[model samples]
Target chain A: MKAVGLVAEYNPLHNGHLYHLKMAKQITKADVTVAVMSGNFTQRAEPTILDKWQRTKEALSVGVDLVVELPMQYAVQPAHLFASGALSLLDSLQIDDFVFGAEHPDWDFNSLVQAENKFESTDFSKYNATYATAFNNQLIEHTGISLTEPNDILAFGYTKAKLKSKLSVNLHPVKRVGSAYHDEKIDDTSSISSASAIRKAVKNGSAGFESLVPEQTAVDLKELKDVNDWNDLYPLLRYQLIQAPLNYLAQTYQMSEGLEHRLKQAAQRASDFDAFMRLAKSKRYTYSRIQRVCLYALLQISDEQMQIKNKQLYLRILGFNHLGQEYLHQIKKTVKIPIITKVDQKSRDGQLQLDYRAGKLYEQLSGVEQDMRRRPIIV
Target chain B: MKAVGLVAEYNPLHNGHLYHLKMAKQITKADVTVAVMSGNFTQRAEPTILDKWQRTKEALSVGVDLVVELPMQYAVQPAHLFASGALSLLDSLQIDDFVFGAEHPDWDFNSLVQAENKFESTDFSKYNATYATAFNNQLIEHTGISLTEPNDILAFGYTKAKLKSKLSVNLHPVKRVGSAYHDEKIDDTSSISSASAIRKAVKNGSAGFESLVPEQTAVDLKELKDVNDWNDLYPLLRYQLIQAPLNYLAQTYQMSEGLEHRLKQAAQRASDFDAFMRLAKSKRYTYSRIQRVCLYALLQISDEQMQIKNKQLYLRILGFNHLGQEYLHQIKKTVKIPIITKVDQKSRDGQLQLDYRAGKLYEQLSGVEQDMRRRPIIV
Candidate 1:
């Protein structure tokens, strides 16, 4: 019952993801494939095109053996934490290999990690630039290869996390086959489009996106009456910023250096999320960073809570096929952490509180139950 | 310039309120009429039919010489607190008389207040009943009367507040005219109807409410698109309750006796405000008490902040006429507290934070600017 694992967002389960899944099985030659996917929110704190369950069903339909949720505390975070959290869960599941996509899959990420280790810790203290800019500055000077693209940075993160955690799983980085991550428009001739491009096509009512996605994803997109984006969630964020006290907001995860005051002022004056972002954006912080902080504030996740929950890891299964069930049976006793098949009162309130809260927030947008006694999908 | 002060919600200024205003002028024989009105929200923690500014315009157009906003801390509170807060502001303005409506104008409310003073302090500790129910039990035993009618309860509160604070203003309890306070429909024969009945008429699209309200109120009601109520604000409440931690909710004003757990649990299960209320309600807490607590949670208001703001009272002018201007000038020298005409940065972030937050929440429904740099209406 050997298994290979993949970490993904599978935002809408496009052809790009299908290709990656196929490559995972081909590259590892494992008996079963297990994927740790983000729950309702992505790493950058954006709501997924489809919910975790819907995405899991899509994954199972496309021959992925098992789908487990990457807990929210890990999902809506920096790339390093997201990569580390997913790898930890996969390692616990005793997966033999981990597959991912990167812009430069052949680059020696291990050397980049070693180069970063040599940089002074105080390099992150530069107040005039963002943390990524500071890190890239050092990287380009040492290795002559700056990590700028999304997957490239994530690849570096995977290498760093693997070395630090001393996990036994092997890492495989395959070349991303289609449209780049940031490409917002779908190419009419291609069957593999980025998730963002598919989402954009759906938003604009453009045709031909059906070819880029699986049957399940196309059906989900057709049923999606409204795209769950910042535009729809801005009112809740604005209300939180305008109402929560400065001291309380200061305690939010990653809220530092009097950012609470700046955010509170912006929420007061800005009429929408874009206007809020424009006002809140600064040289020291990226738009994604501020957006993640806004999500933390909206969910009311505090630094103390995040630090506490980070230590309590779990594998929350979302869906599984017959092979996945057999793999789970094989590894049931050997798994180091809890494997939750259904959400009960104890887990929903205790270890799973963060993900539960995040799911409730997403539920407000999707009008679908996220957790709470919901059983994993079996194909 | 002698002034008679009235306390009102005036959710929408109907003919009943107009008659009350005329009666105040006739009975007090004052040179000017002033009103300390609830802003945006009512005593039951419900959003008004119209915004405070619109209601103020209607008040001034109907010869309410002056209108002052009841601060959020006092506006959305229990009857005693709301009565005391409004009376304190009116007393600061040096009014000659305080007038309000009551179902039993001739009842010995001062005696009732004195009788309440004689009850044992431990009487309120009954765990099986609400504070109001406990107080009523004592009242029924001592005075052979239960203060149940809304205005009668307010009248008792006014008497208690006036006696306890030793205010110099005269107390005038006018007989309430027209529809009963809880009546949901307007009677065709009477021009004077309750504000609730008018709001219901507007909600149901039942016409003929135009004759019940004044010309300005009729115009305001005619232009009303969606009636703002708990139905619209429930999402915000549900989000706050479900996302905020128990300790944070426990700090909410009047959220006592482990009610935070009840509210948080109810928010997790209930999809609407009504369902949330049903789950949250108990024998020990009334609907209004729970509703006010919900508003406090939505605003993220803490008990300590409420206590601090309770002592720092201010007179915020909302609108005025020529006579009202002269009266303000007359009291400008003698007034003990600061008078705010426009919301500056200091006040918006300090003294007016709660009101500003409430206004912002209401603004989401009405699509009108609430408080920043806006001038008071002049008639």
Candidate 2:
């Protein structure tokens, strides 16, 4: 039985995600579908509105065969790393196809990936500009098309990852449905909405978001007491930056070039997350990059530890259907890495420590146990 | 102008403290009154109900001529360390006498201190019992008098500190009035109440605590939006323990043995400060000692850094009246250490960093700035 793989955050598992999940199976004609979903936090370093469990239940309820966690070290990173991490996990699962949504699905991402290779490595070394801006400048110069939309950039990242890793899985980019990626409000006429739009509606207590989500997602959304976001996490982040020693903070993953001092000073002055972002944001670091660094600092994920964990990947199953169990049985002999269903003492402390810590941090907001003795959802 | 010294947490200065201040000046015949008070956190490692500045104002309002902050390195510590640190600062101020309240003021505290000196050092090495318990066992064996009351313990600590340092100042133990140290509710019969009782009354929104405190303290208490304590700080503490590496946690001041693992495990399972303390508490570690270690972890105060800072004592003046200014001027030439009237950038980032961080943590609860360019309160 061939399996189709998808990479997603499923922040709330909206109708758009359901559509994407449905398309993956219909187009690929696979017997099973596997999803590598981010756990607790998004790539932007924002806590998901729903935890990985709630999101997993939503995925299982929507007929996704298998759901596995994208470890925090990879999840809360840049597009290139996130795409690569997700693709590598899918490659481990031995999936036949990988499906994703892109703003311009027909764009030749392969050529774009190849175009980026020809640029001088020195182009990314400018201290006063973001790496994204630097990369886009060279991309627009070479290909006359700069990938700016979230999914388009991710598409380029996915294609680059597939080529660099020589993964045998096929890549399919379907056109994104509903509103644009940045749209904050839901369109009245559409039955689907962006995750951010759904989150905004849920946060504002606005009506009409229920129509844009699956039945389980709508129930979970209604049950949410508070929306998990950076605002709720700012206190812990600020405390970490203010209290952690400069030398210790300097050891955080991706922390470089006296950014520790910058973050520390910003934390000292800013009382809230928005103000902190404004103070920490500069030409060299994107807002998301700074936020991801903040998360790294908060979780105390050191550069050495993250690097070690990045190489030692695992498939932490969050949920599975009967077909997923059968697919797992078929792949069990061939799958080289550990596939964890229940978080045991040894694995929770070792290979899955980063994700466990990240989940614990999220537990502060959700008040739900994130790991430890929690069994995977079986449907 | 001779000065009399007092050690206080103030937390929120009450009528009892005002009486103690009056007694210091009256009994010692000192022209100036000086106080060395805990800053944002108390000796029990709990955030004070009021920030240091507010408490300083209350001190100065009731004629505490001068108020200096007890640095965080010394403020949140065991009785011996807290006493020694406070006494060293008062000694630097060149005061003629030191006054404090005692549950048994007539008890032979000097002999108690001498008895403690006679104890075998190995008596404290028992891993199955707390240092205080072991010390008390030896004390009970030597003098047949076990210091169980909080004030009595502090009196013994002060006597030991004075004897050990050979401080020239006279030690006066005045009889403690009104409520007991452990009393949680305000007693109607007495106008004086324990800081704990006043805090409880304020927390419960029970009336009559206003009459037990000074006018300024009453106003500060009334204006308080929330009571700052361990319950409010548990999240940050839990986050630190859960996220920080065991090696880093082991470096926490007074975090010896395998307490790091115990704290980490407790933080993982316990949802609140009380529960965490219960889980962490054992015969080997007192609740107060565990709480102090938790504070050290939350503040990320390394034992090495704390040792260095403890030796580098500074007189950080929090508030002063005209007489206080005169007293400071009189002692300016004779004082060996820096007498800080304002928190400069150098001090905030260097000598005062621990207190600054503690203040920042307290600021999260109070929404009031603790340090950084803040001038001492002048009356």
Best by DockQ: 2
Tell me each candidate's RMSD, in Å, in order. Answer: 1.4, 1.7
lDDT of 2 by residue, B155-176 (tens): 8888988888888989999999
User: Where does candidate 2 chain B have its weakest 10-residue lDDT segment?
Assistant: B122-131
The parts of candidate 1 lying over 4 Å away from their true place are A122-127, B122-127
lDDT string, candidate 1, A1-379, tens digits: 7899999999889999989989988988999999999999998899998899889999999999999899998888889998888888889889999999999999999999999878866454554788888888888889899899999988888889999988778999999999999998887778988899998889888888999999998998898898889988998998889889899999999998999999999988888989999999988898889999999999999999999999999999999999999999999998889999888899888988998999999999988879996889999
List candidate 2 stretches off by more than 4 Å: A125-127, B124-127
Query: TM-score of each model's B chain?
Result: 0.98, 0.97
In model 1, residue pairs whose N, Cα or C atoms come closer than 3 Å (at least 3 residues apart or on different chains), thus clashing, are: none
What digit string (tens of lDDT, one per residue) describes model 1 on residues B1-379? Answer: 8899999999888988988999999998999999999999999999999999999999999999999999999999888888999999999989989989999999989999999877766454544777777778889998899988989999998898989988888999999999899898888889988788889999998999999988999998998888989989988898999999899999999888789999999989999888989999987788988999999989888999999999999999999999999999988998999999999898988998888889998887887878997888888
Q: Report the lDDT tens digits of candidate 2 across residue range A75-121.
A: 88999999999999999999999999999999999999999778877
Model 1 residue A136 CA deviation in Å: 1.5
**Model 2 global lDDT (CA atoms, 0 to 1):** 0.90
lDDT of 2 at B81: 83
What's model 1's lDDT at A5? 94
